[model samples]
Target: MTASLLDRLMDLETAVSYTTPPPEGERPFTYQAGDLPILISAPHATVHQRRQREKGEEEFTGALAQLLAETTGVHTLYSCYRSMDDPNWDRVSPYKTTLQEIVQSRGIRFVLDLHGMSNRHRFGLALGTMNGRSCPHFEPLILQTVKEQFQQTSQGTAKSYEELRWNHFVLNHARFTGGVANYTVTRFAAEQLGVPALQIELCSSARVVERRPLSQWRAPFRGQPDAIHQAVILLQSLVAVLQAAI
Candidate 1:
């Protein structure tokens, strides 16, 4: 975590990817990976507290993990387990800001906003549009990658996921109910900030990268090697594509 964020946070962190806890269920602040040209974020990945919206408790978390992929190269890392207090989102949100400052200073290639949606809900990840969040070029790229990913999941052509993830939550237009609702961070980071953003909403029950069982994807469980490996792989691939386009 960056000194700037740590100074303003009441969160705790550890070497363990999932062991640390926050004073208010809010994860620690990070920004060391802030220098990376690319970013990977997970905003809806809270620790699963009982009171998701307690007076001072928000329940969503996210990250900027391009550093994990481009560790040796030029990349960054910023992930937050905000309890609905998306640091990358509205100022009204309680979480402090980090991503916006990094983008304003760094030539960020792409902003990957990672998240997970519920089957109980009607949609999958809400890959938010970059229209009002960042630059104009960010819009088409963000939309296309999400659509292509959805198409791959829906089709039998995808080999990594083992089974086709053609669940009803496939990418539809932004007009769908709460379509961009969950992706407000993406919008704010991309269009409003003039940086490209891609909101990645993975379904909690979606098939694993290796077609593994769905029981493993609950919460902070990303510590499991399988889940982390999957996240790393997809994150690396996406950054490569984003870098190429830039």
Candidate 2:
């Protein structure tokens, strides 16, 4: 089962090269349309440039986003090549522009912007709602859904919630408050598009099964398969509950 999951992740990340651009005329991001009214975005899935500095790719975020879309039938967008600009940081970017198009055209009611964080942090998952300004109406429901999902045992895994070590899930964390001070994708989707949005920052241990071969800049490490399984189930549950609510 772990091997199958890894193979799926590898297929999703095959085009994600930090140093390479997609063939000429192709966009840097891939958008998968789904029947649901929700949109899942991973803007920093590939290496991105912010103010002339290059930021490393958020490993496995793209794969997770794609997997969520596949499993939940929700709209998905993720960067698949070196980004000329930071979609989550810049005030203006092609990524944001495309997102606006998607939301408007697809009648999207909610947006979930996925990101990656270092494992050094105490929390396994950090949810940011721009201090309750982004998803004001759905904050309580969203929080409740995440907490409940994380507490349940993951399918196909015998490990209990405590054994998975994913009990730490925080909201509006001081370090990751949904880019309230910056031009984040969540902020753009909420403020500009008038859509409820949340920024979900997952620790490396919770999101990645293994770093892709192209991402050699990151340290060598493998995430526990059980933790990855639980994270996937949690996100799937969150999407299902949110879809039903909205």
Candidate 3:
């Protein structure tokens, strides 16, 4: 019997889930070694706690990282289980400690942290570069490439999204910009690791084509083909931009 690609990704996630907490003293993030200088990460793919409240999963970021690794042959890291600490928010998150080690050991030059956002936002995507402090040299290239990709991919899609093209690029907006006072994962990578990093926030519309209600955030929805397809296009677009930067 043969299993499909989606099945393989699911199996991978399940296997990672089992070893999430580790035996006693193991790292929280699973690091997959790759030859490329890029390290793709999905830190919010699972349920996590932040300031005493339980946060919902981003839905498909784990699968996106896996697919990017399989397709681009790049290193990937992701949180496997419900995190005891918010890796992106907590300044002392253990995930950051291990991330520093990985960056040093693997000589990673770039960190691409993937995240998902609510569809209530105007744009389908948002790039956070900590106000050009993260990746000053490559930020413009990243922005240009992403816009081009979206325009190209949306040729056959809906036209109601025209507003997105005009107001899509939110440069260092107030929300999730990784700017000052924000000790996010990408910020740590840029400052401590000395590597350029960008936080890519994807809208739910681009992934699952629906703004999932908060009440249903915990439910598993990995088998959705449309969501997976959208993720692939976005991943490929980012890969192209990274390759150019390299």
Error of 2 at 138 (Å): 1.1
TM-score of each: 0.56, 0.92, 0.81
lDDT of each: 0.43, 0.85, 0.70
Candidate maximizing TM-score: 2
Q: Per-residue CA lDDT of candidate 1, range 21-45, in tens?
A: 4557444444555444776654434
Off-target runs (Cα >4 Å) in candidate 3 are: 1-27, 159-169, 208-228
Compute the lDDT of residue 116 as modeled in candidate 1: 57
Best by lDDT: 2
- Per-residue error at 217 for model 2, in Å? 3.0
**Which segments of candidate 1 are over 4 A away from where they belong?**
1-27, 34-36, 48-96, 121-125, 130-169, 172-183, 206-234
Pairs that collide, model 3: none
Candidate 3 structure quality by residue, lDDT tens digits, 34-63: 778788988887777799987876766776
